[model samples]
Target: MTANASRAISWGEASARRMERQFLARPAGRGTRVAEVVAAMLGAHAQVLSAAEVSVGVRAAGVTRADVRAALWDDRSLVKTFGPRGTVHLLPAAELPLWCAALTAIPTGPSPFPPDVRVTEEQAAQIVAAIGEALDGVCLTVEELGQEVVARTGPWAGDLVMPAFQDLWPRWRQVLHRAGQSGALCFGPNRGRKVTYTRPPAFDPGPVPEEAALRELARRYLRAYGPATPQHFAKWLAAPAGWAALLFRELAEAGAVEEVAFEGSGAWVAAGDTEFPGGRVRGVRLLPYFDAYAIAARPRESLFPGEAYRRALAGGQAGNFPVLLVDGVVAGVWHQRRQGRRTTVTVELIGRRLTARQERELGEQVERVGDVLETKAQLVVGKVTVGPHA
Candidate 1:
């Protein structure tokens, strides 16, 4: 932290700077390689497969949905699995070991399930191991794999049912990501209509010390989204506050990161990354639901000013709505629905209107979005409606 420096950047300005670092602004994302773009952004949110493709396509020049699919399924350059915050994400295949080592190290918070239904640590470990064994060099649907797990672990692994998504979910399903984080599983191509899982060929889990992994994760987070507070890092990673603070302090002492002032509060940025180019970022983009730009940013109040937060987020969840970005700040919420060969994109602008150039750019962006789905898009600008995407 060059604490004595006399520049206090506003949150809006800080966001614009992040846009450049995030590859959402000028010069655009440089590489044709999707892995490079995913690595730069840390990871691409993959809760919605199509949305994840659009996220990467927008950043990388001339990339498309098929390109991303090929990377995941055919070329095996990428893998879709559970990532930070226990959310689905697309990560570069080679970096899986590092991410898995670091992620598996974080202690899981207290169980959400009742004691009667919760799996014990020993049971959970057994289930994880069974999943690894079942999926080795093979693909199986969730139901098919359940039988395998029960055969290896026990009937208890498949017996407990807990409340989730307004329905009863198998207790053993909880360790799905635990298996992924242990280098035991990854998504495979769909079998007709069912999603399947498989093990990465030749993968042998290497020991990555917990503290070293945490330090590396912290360094990568700052490099990608710096000028951030430890609280921001904690919130984004779903890590405990005390642990994040101690980790930040360790990084600061090592000179890997430094503290800086932002609007009267202290925040940390990667060392040697304090310079901010002068001026607002100029662009109009339609970032999809769960796009890393919206999901990973902190101080949501600044990112979604006015009533925009209520409209873009639901019950404190990011990615509930697609976002319209004007100069790197949330301008509105949008929805895209497709039928047959056409897709309708409806954008409800809040208190602001676009200039002629911005409107034209938005049209081009709409075209790009349609290309991702292989459908013709018809854009509709309706009377402003302030609500979350449905």
Candidate 2:
């Protein structure tokens, strides 16, 4: 059959189904540690207690701290999922290696700053070496490591270390891989046993060719969020458009991915034609900031409403409120407040008033958020109200 004919399924239906399957697929003994569940569902972004707001989102999704813990430390569900900016997501364990490979391969854009301000290839290599040495047989906080890096790299390096490092962060996986190779770093507790990072313990030095990594990333993208365009992948990876297209083509030629048409948009999917889980949409959701669900798609406007999208992308500085999803569409915005002990949640509807059912569903979610925070919560329906008690 032609590619267009092969992918005639409804996109909305597919997305909803995927959500349901993933949400309900929790194992029998899963614990509710928000970090673990976030990692499992989203990938590498998981960590205990750290990024508390994100943890709140996981809880709002009906996952508990115990569930998250079980998923990570027990079920080993943390893996890597690729999306915007080639960032590694904390996906389930089984999916980790594949996602890692994919992100490692994608080519990135040139530094936005001038070459003098940027880390040169030689400087990057030196920084990597310094980091490896500093981290050898020990875990250091960012502050501590900064000191060590500055000490080792010398005064001449000045503050150039951090700027250069931040710029080179897009390629951090490469340095991490090398550190793992040299026994300088391995996966270990970070941020007070809440997170994991490459630190000395069980570092491996296996070979990972560049071409192979890129191809694998392409395959995983198609498998998880496919029937998408090369531009989508490029936007997601924050990589050069031409390189992303080339990588997509390579994967398609290898039979790892297939070009498919969804609506009028040409997209790609995993060769196996695996379907999403939710199987047609239903209830609303409150997605957290920087959530993969928000970052994974491209031309993001297509997924959320215009006003809501602007608020969300504005980095929250412009009173851009938290989002409220109704049947997979951006329906409104919401916020939370904490005082002494009580917690209050306020939701602002943008268009149609929330139906009784939507209000009840939202209330249930608000309570779930309270349960995760171990605080008493009250839901207040309104528009743009702020205070410790709203």
Best by lDDT: 1
Residues 102-128 of candidate 2: C-alpha lDDT, one tens digit per residue: 554556457655544455657656766
User: Among all windows of ten consecutive residues in candidate 1, which has the lowest summed lDDT?
Assistant: 1-10
Estimate the Cα RMSD of every predicted model relative to the unseen true structure.
2.4, 5.8
How well does model 2 score by local distance difference test? 0.54
lDDT of 1: 0.81
RMSD (Cα, Å) of candidate 2?
5.8
User: Worst lDDT window (10 residues) for model 2?
Assistant: 21-30
Q: Which portions of model 2 show Cα errors greater than 4 Å?
A: 1-7, 24-62, 66-101, 160-205, 274-279, 315-321, 385-390
lDDT string, candidate 1, 20-137, tens digits: 7767885354455888788878889887898999888877766788888988988888999888888789998888878888898887888888798899999989998999999987
lDDT of the candidates, in the order given: 0.81, 0.54
